[model samples]
Target: VDGEAKVGWPTPSKKLELYSKTMADWGWPEYAAPAFIRSHIHWEDLDLAAGERVLVPTFRIPTLIHTRSANAKWLNEISHHHPLWIHPEDCEKLGIETNGLVRINTGIGHFVIHAWRTEGIRPGVVAASHHMGRWRLGDDKGRSWGAGKAEIDRDAEGRWHLSRGEQQPYESADPDTGRIWWRDTGVHQNLTFPVQPDPISGMHCWLQKVRVEAAHPGDNYGDVMVDTDKSHQLYKEWLAMTRPGPGPENLRRPLWFARPVKPLATAYVYESGGTTG
Candidate 1:
């Protein structure tokens, strides 16, 4: 350690190494230096139709945290509807006016929501803020930060339809329920999204791309259309990316990565070589 040269960032050298010798030594010279790998969701690759755009799903508003804050009425009031943020230029190109409806089709399913044309977001990208739409089946009489409730129905034909009717003044210890305003409580679009597993980072990617379109007839605000069967199929496809065995590395798990409960060091070696410890 005393003789080791101090290095600053860019890895594998005393100074920033433009060419990573470590990667070259590892037989990946092409990726030894900085490189550009086009994203799978790049606009050029997609066979987009007239109204179709690409979705950028990770954007979030400051008013709320993830899914947990949905029941927080005050926070919901600050930012309620998770409108699909489209660019003004794109709206003109697609004939989609501000606050107009846009149907987003994912690999698994689709959902319809109002579009908000803004310059903050770029064209060719549609972003919906995270976690505004919290719903339960009509039977679950639970109340939360959300201002309204919804009804999800599956007819004999096996098609799923989601709709949120008008919220009536209700009696509750929380007076906020009576004063509850705003009709666009948003839709549960998560069900329509397909799982995207990252090939490089080895993390399950929540931000995914979806194909967008002009809302079809009967598509209303908070209206979501999805095929659960296709969702399962897409899940299977992503799961298929996983290796059959333990891992790419011989170790059970990476030592540095955070785990809720850490196991014995010996267990990390996997003496038995089965799934369990």
Candidate 2:
């Protein structure tokens, strides 16, 4: 059966042109559709990088909240850690088993994560999602469940006492619903990615061109690479703005006088640093 086209909707070619012009105006000529269409980089263009290897990270299902979700009864049952999804054929060559740990490396960075061998991905490429590896949840110093402990001192009478230490627990409440959720925390992937700007779009391309290797069990998945040079530059800029300098320059005289007083009489005496005679 043929489906009817919706009214007021632009044709595919027109839509493509609109997108191309919009992106071009935003300084993304390289990402313009005309260039992509000519180069045959369509939805099915995964294997288009044939004979050449590339690594891409995809986002995990919404239900899972990185490695932290593993502690939750509901989300853990679904899937907690991010596993690298690789083609079955690639697994055979590398002798990698499904659910085994592997080290994914790129020219700029690398991380050790679990591997999920499946036919869902294209060969010669590996895919991983951001989020996982929460260690502080169970640690004594970490506040995975609720607030930290407070110290209190009691007298012999046990009636009254002074409290010495007070530490608030890490708390997160949804702004819209007002429901709270807790977990020992960590920063997101944006911190790990370099601040290098794309030449054409002037946008930060967080995804890096990468490589992968097998990693043993119990490896630290939280470790990630960061561009220290960019971090240092950011720190210097922040320091300059915050440091204090000169105070205000101009001062204005009061316009009105109080009861039984004159404004001009006080102004002249103060300016000359003299006392009234």
What is residue 141's positional error in candidate 2, in angstroms?
5.8
Best by TM-score: 1
Per-residue lDDT of candidate 2, residues 29-102 (tens digit): 56666443321112344332222234555466787654555445445334434567788887776667887766
TM-score of each: 0.78, 0.45
Off by over 4 Å in 1: 1-37, 48-50, 155-157, 200-202, 248-250, 259-277
Return the top candidate by lDDT.
1
Off by over 4 Å in 2: 1-33, 37-53, 65-73, 134-142, 145-192, 216-277
TM-score result, candidate 2: 0.45
Q: Provide C-alpha RMSD values for all models, in order.
A: 4.4, 19.1
lDDT per residue (tens digit) for residues 1-277 in model 1: 5888654563334566777665454334677789986765767876655555667666777888876786777887777778889888888877787888888877766788888989998877778877767775553376655635778788676768888765454667888877877655666777777666654334767755676777888887777767777877877776765444333244555444346898876665656566421
